[model samples]
Every structure is written in structure tokens, then in C-alpha cells.
Target: MCEEQTVSLVDVLEEDEELEEEASAVLGGSDSDSCSYPQGYVKRQALYACNTCTPQGGEAAGVCLACSYKCHEGHDLYELYTKRNFRCDCGNRKFSGLQCKLYHEKDAVNSQNKYNHNFFGVYCTCRRPYPDPDDQVEDEMIQCVVCEDWLHGRHLGRVVPDCVELQEMICESCMNKNPFLWTYAAHLAGPEVLVEERRDESCANVPKKAEVDDVIEPSCKRSREEVEPSCRLKVLQASQQKRDQSGAVFWPSAWRSKLCSCITCQAQLSAAGLSFLLDELDTVLAYENKGKSSEQVHQGHDPLMSALDNLNRVQQLEIIHGYNDMKTELKDFLQTFAAEGKVVTSEDIRHFFEQQSRKRRRVDAGPFYCS
Candidate 1:
């Protein structure tokens, strides 16, 4: 029965399953077969922009996963990954020539959705595409917790700290716009390493908890009305305080929890347009977890693994070699279609393997002469 070749076969399949899981993590839990327009403004979902229709410098637009396939199958797309509080805009006024196939009804615009240069296929301070083919150096794009825009590490204007996945980042632009965040960064930002030996010395201006409470509540327990004005006055004074932030701030894991929850701070948060920062569900990690949980494990995916048990070793090796060869060749064969932004149809895939079979036959028939 199948043995050594069978081991190779199992190894190949295991690798494929891992790749499928990783892809699922990116796609989240969005229904790929259904248009998301009917769902109204989604809190977060994988979205894409079609370069064939919404070109660079044009009105930026986003479509749901189903529309990416049904309406813009052959178009080059900018994978926007995921955006929050967005509704599907497929076949909206921005697109000149495409119509929604999955759900034909759509409004003329999705005005609530946000846009950045990334919708046009550029990223980072360098303004390069995600996989900039012309660049030699390799880099990873890191998303800012504030703007939610992706940036390269080198252009962050600060040295990226280690264990970045364990940290939340506020890009310099966000920090500068709200200088008050620097006060929190100095006093409350965590994971410990980012805090200096002299944190207390540097953040001396920030009021300690008991001091703040004493200022708000006075000598003893007080009614809500009696304490409210004092709390507001103390925090407004605290809000005016700023800490020196020389660069982008890296916050410790679950740093959002460190934010003050007192009534006055809540009012301050609402006033500064930062209430979303308090919502743990708004993080990218939460969104990806939703997608991962939704991924249905297809049953019978490993049925071939069971069937391999009955095959002779010779047949097993033949199957293994064929699978390995086809995987490599098929990938090489598909690159052209991807580069051309063309959708590969079932017929095209069949034709490619047929040509591969003919080429194999020609090679098997060759005669090695004096050379």
C-alpha cells in the first residue's frame, strides 16, 4: 500500500491546509457568495477597489467580496483588506461601467465610508504598492492603531519596538493632532520597556488618582451633582497638560484598558472624537478573530488522505510526483494571468495542463546522442 510516497503526499496536503487557514484569517467572516450591500454599513469587513473602474486619482470606492468576483472578476483590484463602519459601494456612482450582479439594488453613494491613498493602491511614506515589484528591499506594512493606515517600519519616524504584535501603535500624525495623548503615553503606555527609568519624573504633571479624587470629591462622600463640576474642572486642567513625545508612541498590549474611566475622562474622550479607541471590538485583532471563527471547516477535505492507504507504493510515488510537478508548474503557469489582471477560467486551467502533458510526452521521447 502507499508508504514513503504517501508520507510526501500527506506533507504536501498539510502545507496546503495551513495556507487555506491563513487566507481565511485575512478574509474574515464575510459571506463571499452574497452581496454585503443588503447588510447596510458593516462595522468591519474585507473590502476591495477595482482599478479597472475606480482608477487612481478618481473618486475612491470600495466593494464587498461578492462584488469583487461577480461584478469585477477580470478587473485589477486593490485589496483594502478591512475597513470599519463601511457599506458596500459596488455599482455606485463612482464606477463607470460595472453593475452589481449579486445584489442589483444599491444607493448612489456610501458617504460614511472613509478613504486614504491606499484605496488607489499606494501605501507607506514611500507611496509604493504592497508588493512593490521594483523594490529590492523587503519590508512589512504595520497598521497604526489610530489612523488604521498601513506604514512601513522605516518611515514610522521612530524606531519600531520589538514584539510589535504585542503593542498598539499611534502614528506620529495621530499623536501630533492630539498632543494630549502624549500625556497618556508617558504616564500610562505600557509593556514596561517603553517606560523610562524616570517616568514619574517626566510625568510629574499628571495628577495621581487619590489627588484627582480628593480634588473632585473634597473632604468626604458627596452627591453626584456636588462632585461633577470639580471633576470636570480638574480633568480639563489635566487635558491641557502635555508630555514631550519625541516620536510615535508604542502602547503596551491591552493599553486601551489603561485609559481613565472616570465620568470626566469619558466626557473628554467623547469631546475629542476618541470614543472608538475605548472599544476593544474595533481592533484589527478582534475583526480577524471574527473571520477565523466563521471559517467553516470543509468536511471530506482529507478524504484523499484515507484513499491513499490502499494504493501500491509504485502508484503512490507516481501520484506524489505528479502532484508535486503540477503544483510547481501550475503556479508558474498562473503568474502570467495574475500579472495581466485576467481571471483564470476552468477551461484555461485545463488547456494549460494539456499543454504540459504534451511537453512531457515530447521530453520522454527524446534521444540523447553524442552530447
Candidate 2:
């Protein structure tokens, strides 16, 4: 977001000649020279009329630079430039609904507030415009995927780790508006998982080439380009289309604006065991985890245990039973040693494993059992 700046009529009059030429070209043989400021008023500069202020059918209306400053101060005014040589219609009968308050056309408007990001000269946390005339810094600016507004890297407060062309960046404002978007951004920004390596003495016996491969190779790797794509844009567009078709008034405008079906958001929802439909009228209804049971389970269980419980139920049962069986045998063994007044050292445990291997070789039938 940027603070509104007061624009002086003198500054508006001195707009570059190139802009005027472009506007003249756009008008194409329309008598550009014929249009001038009202009689006895010196024509200082040419300017494009505010499309919003122009009567619905008269969108092509143009205004002089002074008239634009006087009448359409807060309006979204387009710059047509000097070549178009247009006069102000702000005081004309066509715009009788809106009266010009500035008597001296050269003076500045009191409150030149701008509502949309399009009118902003600068944006983001830094609040500096692109190609800042005063500052010669040449850093690249990134456009927010959601707002489609440009922002500086420093303002975003993070280095863009991936190639921008391949991935879209959602602004912080957008993320704050939606929990799903926040999760998606956090997931993207989180540190990557690294493969663990065994540095035990036994690993020394492994072949040098194989050992090198084991150390360098990651358990899983994904390229930055692969991670970020136009999928989010496509999902947003589809969601918007669906909303337009539904014509449902139940959905809040704010929620509708934040609606997204990006892969990251979908994956996050899936990880949380949530199922949802994009076109559903009620987002709360589409979400599967809304029930009190899920909420209770989430809040009551330890996070670690809850995560483990998410594994296959059969595997979970096997792990519990296996641990119990191992515990029983270990207790029995310890009791036997206590009765004999003998302490079981580390060597004894190593020997027992060696003996078990030898027994396995001799039997050559059933699986080896250590007792």
C-alpha cells in the first residue's frame, strides 16, 4: 500500500511529449488540435478523461490537464498526453452530477485519495515506486500473484529463492486474508528436508564409490521450477468462473476474493485429511474436518502421537504388539541375570547375536531366533 500524494497542476501540465504522441496515435485523425481549454483559459497540458466519471456511453471524453486536477482529483484518470490537445468536460452538462470544487485550475486538490492499487505510485512495505527517479538502485521487482501488483524484494522481506518465471508469488496481504493461502505460503517457504547419513565405523567397509553416492544423494529432491507453476492462477480463474456462474449471495465478497484451488493449498488440505469441492456454495460445508470429533482429536492428542496414529492402522497395531513382546522378553532376561548374581555386559549381548547367526546357518530352515 502507498500513501496518496498531492499532484500539482503545474506538474501535470509538464507531462512528457511521448505520452501525447501515443494518445494522438490512439485517437487516430480525431481533431487533436481543435480541442483546447475553455475560451480565454490558456491550454497548459492535455490529459485523458476519467473513464469512471464519463457518462457510460461517453467513455472517450478527454479533459485538459488543469480541468483534470480541478474536477477528477480522486478519480482514476488516464494520461492522454499533450498531443491529444483535449479540453476539460468536467464542468460541462454531461458531468452535471459532479461539480468541480477547485476554482483556480492551477491549485492542488485537498484530498487526492486513491482506492485501487492501479493508482498507487509505490507499493508494499517499502512504499517505493518502480524506477524511482530519486534512487538509482536497479533491483528487480516481483509482482504479487494474487494482487498483480509489483513489490521490491526487501519489502517482501525474503530472497526469491526460485526463478520468478516458473512460480507465482502470493503477497502477504493475500496470505493474511485466508488460512489456506497462509499455509501454502508457509509450506513453500519452509526449509527443505535433508537425507540423513550413517557415520558409524561399519560404513567405512562400504565401497568408496557407493559410500560417496550414499552421502551425496538425497532421499528426495524437487527442483524450484517444479514446485512453483501457473497452477495457482488456473485454479483461481476456475474458482472465479464457478462463483460467477453460481450467482450465490451467501458467499461473502472477501471470502470469494480469497478463494483458491492451488496445488499447495489442496495438498495442505489433503494432509490435514480434509476434502472439499471447489464449486460448493458453502465452503464450511465442503470441508470434511468441521465436525467436533475431528476437532477433539486434534486438540486432545499429543502432536507426535497424532502424527504416528495417521499411519496405516495395521502397522500401528503391529508396532504396539511388537514393543510389548520385546519388553516382556527383556524383563525376563534381566530377572534371570539378577537371580544368578551376574551382570550382562555389552560383550555378552554382542556374543549372543553372533551365536544366533551361527544357529541360523546350522538350521537352514526356520528363521533364526535369539534367546
Candidate 3:
């Protein structure tokens, strides 16, 4: 009996090892079965957000790699992860607000290319996107408050007394157009001015007649030169605050006007309008997809399409879906499992799917149905 038990245990161990190998094969298999891209079609680069261009409703959107180099060169760009199996949408009627400068036969340009900045990557007095180390100037480059372009210290000239004192510096062109920008000073003297006012208040109790005379005519008057700096500083501070709040770093220019009408902006505006209409028109008739052909409409739409539309409408109404809840739960489970640093096996995936299926079945079954 003891020998038989030992042989059975060995056989059970061998079966377990085989099952483990099979599970590994199922979970860590090659993805050759996945869809393949066409030959000669090069993979597109990652998406990038153009800080220079503003989308409709003031939200920012990502542009294609070509758009970033061609149109948004020298403009602030934030890179996003590469999206697989997608074409470049820069200069398209949905992503870019301006025409494509580098648009060619290879580019996917449409009616969206309305206005182009004709950006050639040359900017500032140095005429380069970045400072050339060959020049060997130690002065730091400052961004122009108006044009939003980085200007070398030499280009700004004597306008900026010291680069250290520069918080927000306006370009020469902007200052030339609006001379008032030149007079902006720092508002650091506010505390000092308040201290002087407090000192004046201490002398208010001296004599009634003296106090009245002091109120009518100040003991000391600040000269135009002394007061101008403080006034300019206050103005500058106010302007900076306003700009920061509005998220507008660039100076207002004609380029902005052209950008506002770009394809990206038009698409955004259309989407927003449609969303507004959908919300306003909550009737069943308005819920139908307008893009459907007469035959498709007559044939009765796919249940999946109707379900998705209903889900969107319900979400708009602030109603949560069970599927979304299930997704969140699954996401949390996967995250937690990954965090534990354990190798997830096919068993884990199968178990998760089984649990979700059971839950779905329970939901599909009426509440009155028993075990």
C-alpha cells in the first residue's frame, strides 16, 4: 500500500508539471495571429501636443509627428506615446487649426489646410530655434511675452537691464507696437509703500489742525521717477496674473486668429455643437445616428450601436453602467495582481473571466430567480 501511494504521488507531480507548461504556452504565446499592416506603409511617429495652437473651447489636442516638425517647429510641443495603426492627422480638418507647411503627397491633407504659418524653424535675432554654442554667449535666452519665442540676450538689447531681473520680458516688436509694455516695473515696492503709510498713521494723533493740514497736503511727495517704477511694476504684475489665469503664454498676434479657424478648431466646434444638440434634444428621434443611410435606417440598426448610443445617453444623464463598473473592477484586480510582482498565468485570466461571466449571468437572471 505504501509503494502504491508513492507511485501515485509521483504521477500526480508529473501531471501538475505538464499543466503548468501548457498554461505558460497559452498565456505567453506569440501574437502572430494579430492583424498585420500593409506592406510599404511605414509606422507613424508618436502624437505631440502643440502648445502654440489652441483648440476650440480652449482645450489642447495632440497632433501627428509631421505636424509637430513642419507646422509646430519652434512652438512648444509635448510628446505623447505612439499610437499603433494610425495615420498622421496634422493639417487634417480634425486635429490642426492651421494649414500644413510640410504637407506633401505622402501627407494626409484635406480641406482642413486653411491657413499655414509657413514656419521654417528660424526665429529670434539669432535666427535659430535654439542658441548656437559656437557664438559662446553666456547670457541666458528669455521668452518674449508677446511672440512667445525665445530671444537671446543680445537680440533683446538694452531693453532688459539684467537677465536676472527678467520675470516677463516683452519682445522689441511688441514693445514697439505698444510702448506701454516698456514701462512695466516690478511691484516689489508694495510692502515698502505700506510701511510708509503706517508711519504716516503714527503721526496722525499729533494735533487736529496739523493732522488736517497733513491730510490736505502730504509732508513728502513722491517724484515721477520714484512712482513710475512702482506703477509700471503693478501693471506688469497684473498683466502676468491675467495671462497666467487664461493659460495664454503667447502674445496676441495675427497668427492666433488664423489658428482659431483651423480644421482642429472647426471639428471641435462641430463636436461641441452636436453634443449640445444631443443634450437639448433628448427625444428618441434625435437619438438615432444621422450618418446612417436610408437603407440602413430602414433595415433597423445593430443592437450594439443602439446599446452604445444608449450607454452614452445614460452616461450624459449621470447614470453608471454595470459594464463600466465591471471594467473598473477588472482594472483594479489586474493592477493589484501586477503590483504584487507575481507572474500572471492563464489560470488567472480564466478565473477572472469566469467570475465576470458568473456575475453577468446573475445580473441577467431576474432577482426572483434562486440558486
Candidate 4:
């Protein structure tokens, strides 16, 4: 466990490129230049909601990456990131006058597709756009495991652990709606300990890895041996108030496995439309892992190896040397910016090369003297 460190949104802006890299990781380097309508609903793919076509408070519409470029170029768009089991809604009735150029025919509606406030370009209980123009407060946005909607840390009404990725979060609404989870989390939750603290002002739009210090073990963590299986649920229900407050609940990884899957519990879970809770693949982490696996299948080898395969040994060695030189020099040059926490720009790269060029020139023209 470590003390939590909060970073502002302005610090996140520096990671625009990092956001793209993270998206690529989730997308697994899928070709986004072409339309994806013909493919039907992708298991998991990068999604964008065109605000220009489907405005907020209206019909929610999402488009695949290719459609975002070809169908709604220059349109106001919300990067919904990657979503599971979604198809392109670009040419549908939601577009009104527009049709997807890549695919002429698409179903008017995708029944399996899911939508949240994110599709309308708003998120969290606050119902505001990310980096909200009206608000200046800097905070981290957390995604609820149930809704898949991003919520600000402040609005979560709880402390976000440093290692959030390692833990699973279920919002208060979801918790209350499915109170049975309280029993499972209490038994499976790990202790969040206080330790060395570090802060990452990285990409705001991406779910980066962090640490956890506190677990969700509430008063419901009584010894099961003391109570019969039939009476366990009642005891947990009665002791639910032992929790501090109604806030986002974090559980250790694999907490779902420890959840009571008895007939009664399953019946209750199914009644609440949460049978997916017991499914291992239902989690966002599972979706991301699938994306990564697909990416690995799509990209069989490192890009450098692919390039080297086409080159002669001499050319390959030359390329490797150049790469090494650039890597070393760039790292040395960027150390100053890293220390200062400055955002490096294209101009900075150019300036670094210029400095390198000058140093190389001075080295080559050693022992120069004016007589």
C-alpha cells in the first residue's frame, strides 16, 4: 500500500502521443483506414462517437475508426476508446443525411451494441466532457467496471488506489443495486497498505497501471465457520452497514472467483441482470487481453526484424548502428526535459539533432587553431 498522489489534467496533456500509443495497444494495430461495417460487430475495437452527427441527449451513435475518418472527417468526435461487441453505426439512420462510404448497407440499428453517457461525449456522475471547459479542478477519471463509464476521482467519493489497474472498481450505484457483491468483496478484498508514494501525470484518456494500498474487506469478513451457508447471506446483509460509506468499491484481482456461486446467489444475480459478474471474460481486463492477443496474432514479429529481413548484412548493421546512436543521444538529450517535467516537442527533437550535429562537427575538426 502506498499514499495516493493526485495529478492534474494539464499534466496529462503532455501525453497526447502516449494516448495514441495506448490506443494502439488496445486496438492491436488494426488497420483503421478502411471501414469496419462489413465485419459486423467486432469483439473489441477502437470506437468513436461522432458528436457532429449524433449530438448529446439525442440518439447515441458510434462509428468504427475507418468511418470516423472517411464518413465523418472533420466532425466533432468523442474518442470512446475501445468497446466490446460494437459495429459501425456510421451509415445508419442516426447519421440523418450521411451514409458510410465504405459500406453502403448497414442495419438501421445494432441491437447488441451498448451505449452510455460516453457516447454522448459526457462522462461520470458530473455529466461533463473530459477536461471539462467549465471546470479547472484537476482529477483522475476512473472507469466503473459495471457501466464502463469514466468517473472523476472526486466524484467517486473515495480514495483511488495508486495501483488502480490491478484492482477492480464497482461504483456505489452498482454495489447497492447488487448488494450480494458486498459479501464476496469483503471475503476476497486485500489489505491496502501505506508505502512509498509516486505520481504519474500521464495520459488522462488511458487506463494506466497503478498501485493499491486498501482493500474492500468490510465488517462482512466474519469467519464462515461460525455461520451456516444458509444463514451466511443474512448475516452479510445485516452487517452491510459496517462499510464506511456508499462509494466506489475496489476489489482485489480474481475477487469474482471467490463470489458465492450457490444456486440462491446465482438466482439473485441473474434477477438483477448481473449474471455476467461471474463470467471471467466479462471484465474490461479480459477484453483488453483479447485485444492484445489478437494484436500479437496480427503482428507476428518485431518491426525491426521485418525491416532487417529485407536488408543486406551491411545495411542491417548500418541501420542498427544508427538506431543505437540515436537512442543513446536522444536519451541523453531528453534527460533535461524529463528532470524538468517538460513536454518534449518536434522542435525539441530538431534542436537535439542540431546540437548533436555541432558536437560531431567539433569532434571531426579537432585541434583547430587560429594563427
Which candidate number maximizes lDDT?
Answer: 1
Q: Give me the runs in candidate 1 sitting further than 4 Å from their true place.
A: 1-18, 190-243, 261-272, 296-371
Ranking of models by TM-score: 4, 1, 2, 3
> What lDDT score belongs to each candidate, Candidate 1 first?
0.72, 0.43, 0.40, 0.71
Predicted candidate 3 versus true structure: per-residue lDDT over 245-277, tens digit per residue: 111112211211112233544454355432221
Per-candidate RMSD vs. true structure?
A: 12.3, 34.4, 21.2, 9.2
- lDDT per residue, candidate 2, 263-284, as tens digits? 7656655664332223343232
lDDT of 4 by residue, 95-152 (tens): 8898889888788888878898899888999899987989889888877877778888
Model 1, span 10-44: residue lDDT tens:
34446877888766876856778998998898877
Off by over 4 Å in 2: 1-115, 186-371
Model 3 stretches with alpha carbons more than 4 Å out: 1-118, 121-144, 150-179, 188-321, 334-371
Question: Can you give the TM-score per candidate against the true fold?
Answer: 0.64, 0.26, 0.26, 0.68
* Cα RMSD, model 3: 21.2
In angstroms, give how far residue 78 of model 4 lies from its true place.
Answer: 0.9
Which window of ten consecutive residues has the lowest lDDT sum in model 3?
A: 184-193
lDDT (Cα) of model 2? 0.43
Query: Candidate 2 or 3, higher lDDT?
Result: 2
lDDT of candidate 1 at residue 174, scale 0 to 100: 87
